[model samples]
Target: MKIIAGLGNPGKEYEHTRHNMGFDVIDELARRWHVTLWKEDMKAEIGQTLVNGEKVLLVKPLTYMNNSGEAVGAIARYYKVDLDDIYIICDDLDLPPGKTRIRKKGASGGHNGIKSLIAHLGSENFNRFRIGVGHPQDGHTVVEHVLSRPYGEDIQKIEDAKIHTADSIESALKDGVDHAMNVFNPKRKG
Candidate 1:
């Protein structure tokens, strides 16, 4: 079985913030798979279904962003899922807006949520699908930018990123990370 954990804060207040991009992607995946995220175990809202004949557990941790690992580790332990079988989707500020990157494994790069997961899992060897939210203009704090909502063209870019995140996740589950990376990492023209 594979576990996909989308990291973000819970509650309506965090619904559309840049920090919640992970939740947005998982929500979209649930919608596409016709699955209901009603199960309330593992400290998360979870949906179970078969994607490409593979048993998949889609999770949105309710422990919020910083403590995301608690929920994810719980689910992983319960399901006997290995680190390689787990995928984390979260927002990245280093890449330009609307861009996405899929990495087989890596450090958290100072992301609190990913850091928390690493602490709980005791390793940095997990797949990650990072959706770029872009950095703020000069003199803006990253905390402020990530907690804020996107506007205008930025909003459309965020939406597109979410869609692509879901597609890449599906590809990863169906065809492996290398295939997903090859198909998704390059720039695409409209």
Candidate 2:
């Protein structure tokens, strides 16, 4: 079994924010698989399905973005899932909007949600699927930038990226992280 955890803050207020990109991806997955993520467990909303013929657990942390690790860690422990069988999706400020990057494992790159995962799990040996939201323009505060909804062209780009990234995630679960990275990461642009 594999666990796919998408990190984001709870509440409708953050539904379309850049910080909620992860939640959007999770929603996309649930829709694509024709499953409902209304089940709550371990502080997360979950849906179950088969990905590449393997049982897959789709999770959206309900503990907010910063404390996402708590929910994911609990699920992982309860499922007795191996670190290698875990995948995480989140927004990345380092890359421009629309870019999607997949890594087998690495540092948090200054994302509090990712940092929390690294801390609670005590390991970075997992998958990270990052959707770019770009850095704040000029003097804009990081918080404000992430919480603000995208406008005009950026909105379309983010929407496209989300769909592509969701597909890439399915590919990763079907093949392997390396294959998904080779197929999608090379096409990423900042």
In terms of TM-score, the best-performing candidate is: 2
The residue-by-residue lDDT of candidate 1 on 88-159, one tens digit each, is 999998878888999987888889999999998989999999988899866779988898888869899889
Question: lDDT scores for all predictions?
Answer: 0.90, 0.90
Report the lDDT of model 1 for residue 82: 96
**Model 2 poorest 10 in a row by lDDT:** 181-190
Give the lDDT of residue 92 in candidate 2. Answer: 95
Across 1-190, the per-residue lDDT of candidate 2 in tens digits comes to 9999988888978988999998999899999998864698889998999866789999999999999899999999998999899999999999889988998899889999998999888898889999999999868899999988888788999999999999999888888889999998956378
Worst 10 residues of 1 by lDDT: 34-43
Q: How far in Å is the alpha carbon of 63 misplaced in model 1?
A: 1.0
Taking all chains together, each candidate's TM-score versus the true structure is 0.94, 0.95
Tell me how candidate 1 scores on lDDT. 0.90
